[model samples]
Target: MARRLFLHVGTPKSGTTFLQSVWWANRDALLEQGLLLPGRGVNHHYWASCVVRGGRQVDTIPAAGLAAWDELLAEVSAHPGDALISHELFSPAPDERAEAALRRLEAVADEVHVVLTARDLVRQIPAEWQQRTKHGRSQTYDAFLDMIQKDEQARFWRVQDVPGVLRRWGQGIPPERVHLVVLPPPGGPRTFLWDRLCELTGIDGTGMAERATRSNESLGLVEVETLRRLAGTLQDDGMPKSTQRLLKDFVAEQVLRTAEPEKIVVPARAYPWVVERAQQMVAELDGQGYDVLGDLAGLVPGSEPIPGRDAADVTDAEVADAAVAALARFVRHEELQRRRGRRRPPESSLRSRVRHGLARRWTALRARAGRS
Candidate 1:
């Protein structure tokens, strides 16, 4: 068993994707420094997802996926050194589920530490809504806020409920062993989170800035509203869920992602409620006495809100521009495919030339024999 295990469970949208990307990109360097980062690259999310969404049979999960938990433990155990595992999905796990996951890790770890990265709800709320939209949700930003208010068990509350996430994952672990990484507010030093992560994991954070190959890009107000409008049209046509997903992927990858758009932020009207909720969560975490790696003040909501039009107020004219962009992308993709088709085939093989030579020789020989 490893001497220590650091589990970076998450409060999603707290720069988890960027962190994961960096870890994966520098995996080789980390291994050289004696830390085992198991699984495919920097993400062992499928394994963590299987554990959190526990059930006898969940078709969405890959077959034999549950074995990933054991496999991860085995990797850590085989290495007589410290190891790290990360997955943001593990944050929203219910108490019982979180306990089970913890016990499993504890069985193979001499010491276990739970790491939770958090951000203020003011930022998290709109980010969560945008994430839901990216996943094919058709709700407008205003309707999404209403759903959060009305539904106690809504997904927004499930993962973003900071105190609840900490409680479930931090259950029996020593308060000091639980590390709360407070993400610096937007516009703070970009390297702040990376530096703190290195401090917590005892790994080098340098030479890794160039290795981040994955990033979760946020959609702009117009881009998202346009997609939502497209979704509505699909719904009216009774488009299948599978088709809707493909359409969303196409627009997101082919159209929306071509250029970084101005990000959507929590509206001015919603700012006060968001601040209050964040303060409540901050108070809860403060009482727990966890080892906070960054400034607790980072958890406080920022004062300035970035300007964005509400999704519900998006006009057809605004969507038309996005539609034109999507059409251009389609044309470009088609031209690329045509160019690929027009490329010449490679030269014929030596064996084919030999066969042709032999055939010609045989034909000449037969003709000569007949003449003789």
Candidate 2:
């Protein structure tokens, strides 16, 4: 039992990956300062666990190899220092799940604080759909926008329904215990998402480290089209789960290490509409009166902030060029990573054998090819 169990419940796409990276990078330093971030297998097995719980058929991992969710909870309770669990999908849990999380946290924690970091959904949804595109989702930006705003069949909630998400999770947990870190601002120090997160998470400003686990998604329209086309081929070829996992795992930690996870996606450009809608939703949330942070900005009815338009209005020719350049960069980065990985790791005998086998004949073969 720790003095505080700070559950970083996410409202997603609000720099959750960067926050997790910071915490993991400084885990040893944080431990010295009485902060403990525990996961199932020494790593925050949170995503794997979440995939087990809510991921679609494609996300389905091996059930037999999957560790029970309750066992994961026990590990969280056993850890010393101020406990912290971060997984963005935990936003508004199902009634039973939320109740279970709260009960377990209450029994083990001296006190509990729900830390929610949110960006204006006006900006978040389109970026999210761009992400969905990166992950092989074929839904168009307009279609995804419709679902985020109005479709109930998908079980998507209004992004402005922040308090509702809390209400679901905070049933037994007290209202006072919840904290919110809002992105952007009503005024003063237009907060970049990272700085605000650092302020709230207690990570020292001077000690920033390289992020771990590169972003799971990033794509401009053409790259998205490429992936969408790939997904269609996947359906035809019956791509195996194991094959997808191997590629994604490497891509996450390696290929994306240098990739611009955020591209100027059209879906991102259309986000202002989502902002307007979210403003109405936030107004309703504000009336309910809960722990609040971050202004909904232009989304609020009377308080609509002028949209700071980025280069989204660029012509199709410009967009096509940008997309082409982005694809080149992504492919180049992946190629470099492949070369580096092959050159490195001779630790295992199998790797040594593979390395020697490549080294022994590859130069001669390359020389022959060059002559030809």
Candidate 3:
């Protein structure tokens, strides 16, 4: 049996979650079919990749996880058939770490391959902005636009990031070994991303059954403003880190049920250099025969260029719904705040609050002492 491994590195919001879900649900079946999807504690294969990519970013791969990685590789080496590991976070790693990890992977398996699914730039930018906002960012599309324009140094929106992403995982791997999956045209084909993976892996996607995928979408300036205003006013909507994550999946499923795309404006303050840089990158990649992931070559200029969308139709009803959502968020935030209040304040928090109160009381006490 050949020891081959397929690694799917995700560019977050590009359906990584769906693929993860697919592997998890079918783990037993896959193992029976002579395939492997490791789950020592959880099914976050990217954790191993992250460790392989070097640990500084998302908690130094815990010691247990580090040992687990070794065990995982051993399994891969001994397993009779093939295996799969995926985590899109791998897409952003610096080349050295990515290659270092791939090298480790290659040592364990006879063949190591890379897969990345991409959407167009026109949609990705705003989608990312919305993703940030959902997690408690208050940056307006306008401000985000400003950053995109002037923050050319920031790698998130740059075309440079795309090639950088590829160069990392593609190390010691042939171009053909790197498979690029373009999201099929909307409403065109079913499970296009999954089906493509099926084709790439020579597995039957249909047997796995199709389910909804998680995606990030950007809100329009107005819609974003609405959420921001609501966040400011609502005490509950604070979205503390812990609860926010758990809620995010639920919100993504229920609240954000598929909506239409929203239009956006890309002013000079937003992505000023993106147009030119992306075009340059596209040309550069095309010349190099590199398949530019997503629609970077097609990214538009100007504030009017709509970014990727999360949902659409911001009707009065939707706005009202969002308002209710804001209240729900506020309530959660307040609940957390109250819970925090009840806690023995971290000695630091207690001292700080008491010091300010004492300062105010001292003035009043001094006045009374003077009067006496």
Which candidate has the top score in lDDT? 1
Per-residue lDDT of 155 in model 2? 35
What are the lDDT scores of the predictions, listed in order? 0.73, 0.54, 0.58
Q: What TM-score does prediction 1 earn?
A: 0.85
Evaluated at residue 117, the lDDT of candidate 3 is: 70
Using all chains and alpha carbons, the TM-scores for the candidates as numbered come to 0.85, 0.70, 0.69
Clashing pairs in 1: none
Candidate 2 residue lDDT tens string, 289-340: 4455555443332234334323334333433343344345546765786888
| lDDT-sorted candidate list, best first | 1, 3, 2
Model 3, span 287-362: residue lDDT tens: 5444433444343333454444333323434454444554455457547868888654453432233233323333
Q: Point out the higher-scoring one by TM-score: 1 or 2.
A: 1
lDDT of 1 by residue, 243-359 (tens): 544544555656565476766778887777777777777787776789998888777787766677666676555566565665566568658867889664453343233223323
Instruction: Give the count of colliding residue pairs in each prediction.
Output: 0, 2, 23
Backbone clashes (count) for model 1: 0
Higher-scoring candidate on lDDT, 1 or 3: 1
